[model samples]
Target: MARSQIQDVIRCQYCENEPAVFHCVPCGDELCPRCKVFHLKSKVPSGHNIVRLSERLHPANQIKMCEVHSSKAYEICCKVCQVPVCIMCIQEVHSEHAIGKIQDLYEKLKAETIEELTTIKTQLKSEISQRIKDYIMGEKGIKTSHEDIREKMKKQAQIFINDISAILAEALQESEKDERKYIVEIARHTAEAENFEQTLDQMIEKWETLTDSTHPVELILYRKQNPDIFKLLKLPNKLSIVMPSFSVGQINKSQNKHQFGKLITSKVNLIKSPVESSKHIQPTMSAKGNKSKKRVLERSVKTSQIKAEKRKLCYMACRDDRSAYISGDGPGIQLIDRSGTELDNISTDGEPIGLAVMLDRSLIYSEYDNKVIYKVALNKQKTEIISTEHNPGGLCCTKSGDILVCMGYRGTARVVRYNSTGRKIQEIQTDQNGERHFSDPFFICENVNKDICVSEWNFLKSKLVVLNKSGNLHFTYDGHVIASILKDRFQPSGVATDSLGHILIADRANNAVHLISQDGDFLSYILTENDGISRPYGISVDRHDNLWLVEQEKACVKVYRYL
Candidate 1:
């Protein structure tokens, strides 16, 4: 009784005579000790959360009252108006509207609020933290790039200085040699003049002494010795000094980056909202692992075949959805459409061994006759982009507009990367173990992950060599053991990668195209002899993810929708 009467300001809502002792959470009912006993006898709902008045979800006796009927508390909620109503209001204005228990709606909304808070505290926060870290890393990358560019500029200046010093030293040495020879000739002439003067003085003194004196023998002997001296002494031919001259050359004002080098700045946006990410994100479904499902090659259908005049098709580079560039043991590279109509022709010195296209639709190709890579612009103007030290076998243009060249001379093979303007950026030759990465890299491609994939063949066996963007050796894939028909004759000719990071290699000897996971695991033969593909040499993936294959035997390009 004393506990019930502890507080007088708050009385029992059920029995307003004593202070409230207990509260029902679901019903929102306040009860005193005396009223609580009667309320329990009235058969309250099961699992009703009842607690002390102090522990109530709301303040004691604070139930919401209907605004239309001030004397009544809200119990039912109108579904149509979404408002709480009392018994009198429900019977009058809310009679036509659907009604629900107000307590149920309150519980549902409460649960939803709690769930949203949890998500904000966990997942949303974590995502924000990760993005911040990525931003910081990007900042560091920019600074590193700045320092690297400065270092390159200093190195190039040093090279120019060294070259000029060598030329100047050679010129100075030649000039000094000419000066020494001129001085020797002048000294010899001076000595001859002095000797002639001395002989004249001696002859004059002898003639005077012979005129005054007595010995006829001395004068006679002197006349005999000096007989030709009186005739004439021809003066030495006049020596005119011929000085060395130097002409200064005019400085080249052309700011071509290929001559020296230039820094290229690219715009990068790192912030992405969920809605924006869906549109900007690449199709990375292939990167997702599917270990549970068995790998199988889906049947490929040739959607279109493009006939070409060149019998030996070597490489194919897709320019867009409508057209592609094809090269082989031919005089020029032909740009053709699906209907086999020639759109444009790029003349080459000889057969183009490597072919690729830039993002701007410019054609990049390397000819077998020269160790140089050339770019053909949209105006049909061709310019030398890169001059490699060795003959380039294949060329690939990366998403960032960099070119990867597969080059080798004699037994040495390597993959070199250059920026769009032809400055050497990277060279992937030996691995961490100092071992050669490829025997003969014939074709090259960049994967979705920026891994450099090279099709290497040494006539004995062919392999697919893959390296990470940092030029580290990722893996090397020889032909799968199950390919018994290509046991000893597996020759990887053309290599390409798709949006899924899956690598596809054309096996010219086996008449198949092998698809493998980016991790170097053999997936399946996407195109085989059964699919009417014979001597598939060059392969490429279009912007729409369609596979383009050049069939050497058919002298045609086949577009397949294997994906």
Candidate 2:
């Protein structure tokens, strides 16, 4: 029924030059002999329901369409065959078929269609009602979950306040005990001084009387009684006391702020407490609640918190699986073994952000102040590499011995690769739409499959962007969520890769390191805060696959068995 068929004289759809000898109903196409064979052989199967126009010449059905030759008009019918026919079909295709007018069967067909609609309507009504019931149940479940979460958070806040109050009470108790001892010592010294003062006053009075009376007997008596008293007065004061004072410090300020209590005195001013938490009238945990709670209170307290080996390690790069070079909270980059033993140190001019290894196995490290990525010789010599147009953040060495540098300025970012000789090989910047991908890209590394992975953080989110060897995008990975700290998002600072293609990223906010697959899927995490990891900054894997963590606040590097 297309208007094009009227003006175009019904040409074959397959072979446009030839008049269509037949129209195929199922295909909605007109075809000549050659194209019809191609369609019948390859395009149509026994499955296609088609009508030839010559066979559909009855008036009622003809206006609709032919079963095979679907578009042309059929003007004749063979009464003996009871079938419709066109000129070519009557002669070559359906010469022996009986034909009839389709107008004669229209009323019966229309009646059948109306009857079928009733059955479809009844079936559709039941499905719609069931779907509506499911939607209502789903809505109720969502609201119930929201209500449960809101109530739980409120309870947690109250529990947190109780913990803080307990710490304050305990710290105050320590000061009180010290004050009581000071008061007792003061009272004892005051009583002894009064007795000495009394004896001296009496002796002086008796001496005055004896001198005025000129009596040798009276003077001798006073001298004999006061001689021992004078000796006692001349002796050093054993009860001398310095004033009582109390000192306090933030307990693990960089770690858990919730549990804090420091008892400071002159003899032990900066000593850490033996107890991990303060004594409190704690609420008895419900048997049901104990199974799921993972807050700091629920976790077991370690006896000795692991501190750093030496100065703070803010940045780290692996020399091998056993040792790494670190920089932070100190001037020089110190090489330390897996056990945190200092092996070597290379002095740097400023605070460093990241480090990498070059093809020559010489160390390359980036500092916060400079545009150039500096290289330190194994012999402790220093030299400047190429200067970037922007401040460099992360340096990662590719297997080809080339270096990939993260560069950015004015809140924009890109990655540039350079050969060992300071020649820029390629730059990977914007996406296909020409928008920069990073807010503040910090550390980067390469996966075993040659995918360059970059860790980036801004106020909004901390995420990783991975690119293939040719700088094409692979996927982005955001850090995993911690149920204990639901309000705070994960932020990555340090990045590293293990031999098994697992990526490790250090998070300062959560005090944990996130482990992810090489293809950017989140795997699991190493929770350090529970084990007393404070402000974990720099991260690296040693040759034995032990994880080296820089405890920033404690100014030390701690190692762990991660493999």
Candidate 3:
């Protein structure tokens, strides 16, 4: 059976012909498809079992082995020749040249490829993470921008609504005034018409009685005699009647031509930074000397160098060793210490113009705007309104506890004395030398012997006039020096008396506080620097002989303590 199976199956390796016997006997296998002998046994070394071939080729028996030298298979590459070769080829042709094994070269190449791919993957992950973060941040920014836009739009809409509401309120008020005027006019005209009709009816009744059939001659005589009555009964010159028109559109158009939307669009503006409504205070620092030019406080006591705090819209009154009282135009009075720290606040509805402390420490203030005097308790619980006949401007409490008021501007500057129970007992300064004591008296202060000193505004001379308790002319302290310095007419606003009986006047127009002796001697300036006192309005002297000055324009209060 083995002989019959191999009968025609054996073919040449290079030629398609049956081979009688196998030609290449290295593997001892027949060729197929072509009768070319790929490998053959070495004839020179016949029994050595060595293989050779016409050309280098793969072995038919072993897939990975070389046919020429199967024992020395392809295990290395000739680096110089750049070709795969066996160990035998290295010894034959590439022995002296550099060579490397195929497995080692392949491992190195594989490691490099793996490293490069890993690096590329890491870079891609980092790039993707950054892109995601950027996208999220961009989205958040867009959201915030949209919210801001919406808030701005809402504010704009509210502004428009407020504008419209204000306009409507004004229109309603005008309409109310017009309606009242029209109604009153119509009522007056109707009453006049009724009176005219009644007069005509009375004349007709008299004429009808005279024209009765029983008295023809009497009627003629009566008509002839009473011709004036008929003339008087005639309707007086065409009743001047005025009928109101209901065409509010024409009136509204004539007054307010612009529509609500157009008006708002034209007038509405977005305010970026509104001005603060609080008062502003100026701080005081050391001034440089004239010759030495060194910054120093003028007074010996450092406590005299007072610093300003937050300013308040108020009028400054009395100042003692510990505190000063500030009466605001609003509804409260603030008590501040020498350090400008607020200690207490007392509430009063009346705007206090002038304040004076009684001997018992009770406070009395004149409400010039309300034309009344009020007594404020130290405990801030009791407040009594003392009704005065004159419109009081300035007030002063005497050593005897009698209150004196300066009635200004009414041409009747009279001082009325009030008891502790607020009773008017005496009238002082009524008429001096058969002429009025003052045209407009502003301020009053008492001396140690209860002698009163008053400041009077002389409109004729445009100067200040001083008067004593007996209505005797003391002196006229005009701003002569101040007028020379400012080159204009200077007016004095406030006056005070110190412990030494020195007079201090606030020369407001010159922005300085002037000091004078009781006998009208012009002393040295109390405050002369521009930065020290600005628009000084009120002046007061504490028990310590220090000067408390008020800057009305700047809403500030400054204290200057004497050494």
Candidate 4:
């Protein structure tokens, strides 16, 4: 047998040879059959509490004897000294100091410490991980931008090869030199960020292990030794990469090759970074001195509203650029800036139903009319990626670059998971009882917890269905009972999730947005017509947790800060 396969044996405290089968709680000693008799007759009293070794209480929960008065267990907590004391010690040293029950103080401190640790862990998992992803994605974007500049240069060079071949060589060389320099710097920064991400991962693992521990003394000692462990870690500054630009001059054969366009080097700009998120976060505690309740989603403040060019906003996908791709009745998807100015337009085969942006900055759209899914490259080239049997309505790109598509034919609806190459991996349609869970999954998005949330609607009824990563039904939501009073039938449209794993569903009929917990319990009404939201169709939560919602009636996308 392997060493790891061997079970540890607990020897008797007194005999050391025999395995301990009994435990004296008050004496904090374990004894075998022979030692138990001797232990009972010796120092330990016969009336002392004895239990089976298997029933031994965790040492952390065990009553600690006071150092000054060993006969009495700690009963009072001195607020001035922040220490536990016995009745005798309180009378001698803590008589004038404020005090409370030691057990009550311990519970409060533990709750506060655990809440802080949880906050740190949440930041490490969401913020740090997102920063790492951003770093990597920025590298890819830089490379893509570089390739695009080079491709343009190649085309320009092909036109005037005879006149400026030598100068073209120098320009190309200079571009390569700049690329090498910037790529190296980016690689170094990426490595540093990755190392920090790893450290945060280790810290999260340590927190998990510590929180799992049942020993109170160890937890208290750990907190004392590492006072800052519960606090949020300071992450590195956010750096923005500026894409290099090339100024192309008029192609004049008479002009010298030196007059050719020059390659401007890319720049790395440091932006004023916000820690974790925009909102100031503190350790949440319950007023009733209980475990912290689940975070509540409150009505958001409408910050900006941009009028989209499209008449009816079908879908909206956002990028790190603060720009969004809006698709509607037209056969083209328009990329619009934060101010709603159209920057570029990519033509599609048909009206794009589902639009999503991948980590590589590529765009994916599913066309219901063509029954096909297409990928638009960074160079504006569109190619058919997947041919679906059923019409594809909504789609999203996962963290792993996989695509989740919502497909429906007639009345049957299902969600299919596919790799970037269009290889089908899994399908979510039926439950354990073989009953269909969706009639028409119109919009789909994945939560930070990897739960796949889909808003399914048809003429009969509508609901929000969430499934685990493994395709098992996690939960389902049909509108809040009280909110249903405004409308008889639930009509769920677009769906999005925030870092906190709260699901935001667009209720088109009610002209509101419903916020629910990860487990499908309704938390609150995030937005309603009273907030000037009309026919909210599509919704998305950006990295900053700001909600980007599309109002069909208004023909605009609204940004809100709800956190």
Candidate 5:
């Protein structure tokens, strides 16, 4: 070889004048391309750890597996003990605890936090902006009206008016504080989310790339390695916006003296209950029906069917993300994704019949035989949240996070409300006349106005019952009375409400879904057998106002855009 060429060539481990690329760490040899291939192929040096010079190891990216159980990865975490535990460790010590895979837990937490973050952006943020705009826009009118009224009123009346002005000012300040609190929370949460999201993205990329590649040794070595970035998920910002109320009521004569009447400027947490609804909310009981049809109603028709397993769908509820849940005929509650795939199957003691999902994805279901209500956690753990005296039927979670269950049987039917922890808060049985409001109350739902709608069924009396939040019988609807059509009783099985204050009832016998206006007038038959809906029992409306009707006999959930 020439002297200059020989000097330029990096020597292989076994020979000189050979250009080298890879360094075998275990063999401690900088190998040329041919030697590296030979080393990987040879029996003695085949298992050596090799790395390219350009790909030097970073200490920060290195992960350590379980030390005690050498070579075993530690993927699972014992939440109760607050420690990382390997699968072997779970069988040894951390058995029967709230154990979760670090990756799974992080993803779940991220999804929830992101959902809330989106809510803050879309609903809370938009609502605050509109509220400010409304208040500001109305300020000029309010000032002009007040000034004109002040000239006409006495000094005491003017003082009362000034008091209202002060109240409005205080309301503005409270709203500003609310807006500022949300702004800070969003900023802090965004920063934290960005950091964690980037870290997770890199980790997931590495995991996917390495796991998919033919690196058996590295895969085996890091099989159970769990990242400690899990703590970032627990630090999620639970931003809840509490909208304030600023009301200026009418001035009524009391003891012939002028006073600031009903200045409602209470700043209440909106996450708990309904935010600032006007007193014009009429109970579903007193729902005044309109016989005259003014506007042409757009009915919901079956657009497509969800590819689910069985046709015997007893009851179903749509989650916030449009995922439909149903109780399997046998054991466990089934969670179906948007593609109709059973993403999760949670085992329970017995088969739950009626299922309901809260806004927060809390799956509240009822056990048919036992008449019990349960809340299903993310880890497939079942917690008995409500035990009813009567056999509980369908379950629904109110906007205030209260659980409403159909607790009744033949001859005695009623609706009952309970707190989260299986505690019965109140029971509604007979109405003001001491007469039973329902007979065989099966399915129930709470409206935006907190009204309870029950589908009461019996061979003798089949009717749809609607009561106000206070248990007052507002109205009772017996199916659409059309003698020309020769239809039987309503025999409503499933009930749900839409954003437009409309009550939807699924009638299995009639093979139709009756749309009732919020005021209790029969809007129209939104769905029928003609619309590819037959034996439609369990039904619900998704966020997009699309009707998800489960035809039990057909064993499918059909989606339709009505509203």
Candidate 6:
């Protein structure tokens, strides 16, 4: 037989009574349903495990109830010791004590506990509602993300099918043309053979009839006339049909196909979706174990740092905040509060060119002449030095606190990363194909997704270069028309991004600031005034998303608030 499950009984912490029904108020002692008793000194009456004598009694006013106690009325709690006592006990034990009514103390304690319980219940309800709202939002986000991916996949599949069908149709037409050409050539050759055979038969009959002296000469003349006839009749055993050899060059013209050189030069080649090499091809393993191991170490260090500083303040108002720092060519980085007050200014060894803030609240500023980054602390102290290869033009800090500096001159541009200790960790001066990155990288900023964006100025083109985290070229955007409309002097000088991932570029020559999307799409202009900005060199957006522009020639920093 199976054993029946037993239910556990709930009990008060202070009492050891079984099947506890009543809860104590003073020290939360539990009592059996029948043994429960309530002291008159207790605060809470109902909803408590301890039962009052009045609730168990039959008549409400049968016993002469005291006005002070309400149930068993008492004149005073105590005179000297402030302890609850009957009139007789108070006169003997606490005669000289200042007496107080028991009812007043009981009412005060009851009110306080009721207030506390009400506050606790309100807090619990609020927390539960907030959690429910968060769950709903999370579920909505997941659904939207799934729908977006599905739509993208559907469109991508349609494009692939269209491209494939076009390529296959062209191939089929070429194959059919080659087949028809071979068929026509075979028919023409057969007709030529029949004519040659008929001519030979007529010549043989004439030779059999004429056996005279003139017959030999006639035969010789006929043979000379048709000297090439026999040679033509004995057509080569296998005629060269000249069937069209599929060039395979058409495959190269298709954009979807990979480079032919890469395919042919590779050790392993694929034919009709299968390997068809005569020699056994061993798997080629990479020899970059050391490099990969270093990358893993760097990533681990970055992850640990992120975990340490887990305090995430998503919203910060920069208008009246002193934490926002800006750098210009004046002297050094100007430390200002949210109210735009200059708290303190730190001087650099060389002219200030760029500024970036690290995770530890330390400021990194690049000097133009010295080509070095000076680390400044909050105490107005210079700490470390970061050396760069070229004249540092721009500075930005990544999410992992890595510093990215833009350096370039003439026809070369690069974005290099450095660790917090002023050591160069990585450099990206060229594209994946080993081509020079850009003409001149004037400004650089890291996006939320870790991609580096550069404002480049070439002799003929002024554009922005977007590169992935691995330094691969992603896209380029040319502001040709906008530059021309602004009087052909739209050189991008300073670049910065907001929390929303919107990029703002200061067009120094054009005297305006252009706003661009995270994907290099031109959104609009932050500054539409023609002559409002004067040689803007440094640009920054504070925590409040207010635009700060450093006008180099004007020798003034302009602040614009978002309306």
Instruction: Tell me the whole-model lDDT of each prediction, alpha carbons only.
Output: 0.81, 0.69, 0.63, 0.81, 0.73, 0.61
Report the candidate with higher TM-score, 1 versus 6: 1
lDDT of 3 by residue, 118-189 (tens): 654666457558867977887787777768766876777788679979988998888899989878977877
* Predicted candidate 1 versus true structure: per-residue lDDT over 1-563, tens digit per residue: 78666644577887688878898765768889888777766664333556888877555335677786798777668877767788887775567789897777777766766766676567667877998898799889999988988899999988988998999999999989988998998999989888878888887886789877858888788778778767776665667866678888776657535577766884686554665333222222244433222233378768899878987887899998668999876679999988899988888887888889997778999975688889998768999988888888899999899999999853678889999999999988888888788877889999988999998887666788899999998998888755554544778899998767789999898888889999999988888888888899999888767889999878889998876
Q: Residue by residue across 1-563, what tens digits does model 5's lDDT show?
A: 59998677657766655777777654567787777777887676225567774453543123447865776656667877656677677775567689876656656656766766776676767877987897786777677766866665666677777887998899888889988887887798789878877888887887787779757777666655654445455545666756656576774568344333333332334343243331122121132232121233475555666756653677788874447787545766667866677867777777777788765566778876786778876545678776666777888888888888887686657788887666788888897888988778888888867889999887887988999998999898888865543266667898999766789999888788888887799878877766667787888877666778887776777787775
Better of 1 and 6 by lDDT: 1
Q: Give each model a TM-score.
A: 0.48, 0.44, 0.44, 0.48, 0.49, 0.46
Candidate 1: Cα lDDT at 317 = 94
Off by over 4 Å in 1: 1-297, 483-488
Which 10 consecutive residues of model 6 have the lowest summed lDDT?
299-308
* Local accuracy of candidate 6 as per-residue lDDT tens digits, 329-438: 34554566534456566666665666677765667777767777788764557865777778887777787878888887865467788877878888888775779877
Give the top-scoring candidate (TM-score): 5
Native-vs-model 2 lDDT? 0.69
Give the residue spans of candidate 6 off by over 4 A: 1-323, 327-330, 338-340, 480-485
**Candidate 3 vs. true structure, TM-score:** 0.44
Regarding TM-score, does 2 or 6 come out ahead? 6
Backbone N/Cα/C clashes per model: 0, 27, 10, 1, 8, 12
Please tell me which model should have the higher lDDT, number 2 or number 4. Answer: 4
Evaluate residue 89 in candidate 5 and report its C-alpha lDDT on the 0 to 100 scale.
72
Off by over 4 Å in 4: 1-298, 483-485
Question: What C-alpha lDDT, on a 0 to 100 scale, does residue 413 get in candidate 2?
Answer: 80
* Model 3 misplaced stretches (Cα beyond 4 Å): 1-314, 458-462, 482-486
Which scores better on lDDT, 1 or 5? 1
